[model samples]
Target: MSAVDVSLRRGEREILHGVDFAVRTGEIVALVGPNGAGKSTLLAAMSGDHPISGGRVEIDGRPLDRWSPIALARRRAVLPQQHSVGFPFTARQVVRMGRAAWARTPRQDDDDRIVAEALTTCDVEHLAERPFPSLSGGERARVALARVLAQDTETLLLDEPTAAMDLGHQEEIMQVVRARADDGHAVVVVLHDLGLAAAYADRICVLEQGHLVADGAPDDVLGEELLGRVYRYPVTIGRHPETDTALVLPRRPSRASSPSAQP
Candidate 1:
């Protein structure tokens, strides 16, 4: 079964213009771009949360619309950029909800086991009994992630999962995501931190103003020239001394010469 094909559009907007990409088994693809670049829109379309105005989204070589809601939930898990629960629910209760895809009768011991593993994986075991609303932003983010992890789907889609996290928590989340990819799950993450993307992503997909400007390995996609064109700023790209990964540094925008100074 192929991973999936995700595309979307809006009236006259055309958020995603037939963006074609694939996620192989056991690979982590990071989608990076500036604001309003359609990163979140693409993720929404892929997760079945948003209707595609034109093209379709597929999973395992079949159209996503063909799968029943529960079937799709069982096959793919999504952690959105924002998660809020108005109803007061304990963290454990919320995390357990991820198992809803598999809960045909009642909560089984296997569900508890998976929830425990997910909580530990996301470092939220200590907060399992706390109310979801009482936890800090970072803690709540971790709990939200734990919920998705508990789903135990073959594919995971995350949108800015670490945006509200601390450095340590960010590392923890990235580590868990990388481990998931290593375990043969197709993982897609929308990351604002290019450094983190470079460190963890198997490939980087760059978007600019709702268009896919570049899609390739970090070395090729994150070149200085491409970065400058997409971001409209001067930038430098070099290899990290410690990790040998691509490092990007933004420079001041170059000034345009006046018409009279064209020579």
Candidate 2:
């Protein structure tokens, strides 16, 4: 999927300012920026959920408007930032809903198998029988991810898939994303954790105040000076001992210089 010079307006205020972004097959592109930096807005535009006042979104070399809803759903799946299920449904049932787009099609017969595979891939198979609402935040996040995976689309647009999870689950979700990208799927994820983005993502795109500031491989785009300016805080980047990838950490003020230590 590709968003060419996309600009989106919410009412009178514009959220995204002509951002050009794309996620190619077999690539995991991580969108990283500070809060209110228009990451989610860009993702919405890419998914066709929000209207763009200017520019176009294309899928498989065709404009987003040219494809039918079901046809689009068959090619790409979006997991929005806010996913809530009002109905009382079990995890399995919730996941099965992803196959709705394929209903009445030949793939309908493979629903059960596909859903099960998605559940296991997301590490939520154990929660398959549990009520979605009753599950904990992390569990719900995983189950929601499973639903998206069950859609079996070639492109996966995930918005903070690990926001509510613990460290273990966070790593698990990243692994799932990594596997998907390795499997020749296009994956775009919004992440606040720069370390994970550097470690797992093939490319990183930085946005500030709705503008695309930088876009490149992790080593090229995740520089300390650039990130500090974008995040409005000092940062330090180092190489991981084992992986040799960039490891990003905030530079905190020392106690002697901190405000709390002032007279």
lDDT (Cα, 0-100) at 8 in candidate 1: 68
Give the range where candidate 2 is weakest over 10 consecutive residues by summed lDDT: 79-88
Taking the tens digit of each residue's C-alpha lDDT, what string does model 2 give over 69-176? 999999999887776899889999999999999999999999999999999988888999988989988889899999999999999999999999999989989999
- For model 1 the TM-score comes to 0.91
lDDT per residue, candidate 1, 1-263, as tens digits?
23233446676667777677677779999999888889899888888898886666778778878999988988999999888998889999999999998877463558989999999999999999999999999999999999999999999999999999999999889999999999999999999888899999999999887677788888878888888887778788878899999888887444555565566
Give candidate 1 regions above 4 Å deviation. Answer: 1-7, 105-108, 252-263
Per-model root-mean-square deviation over C-alphas: 4.9, 1.5
Q: What local distance difference test score does each model get?
A: 0.86, 0.93
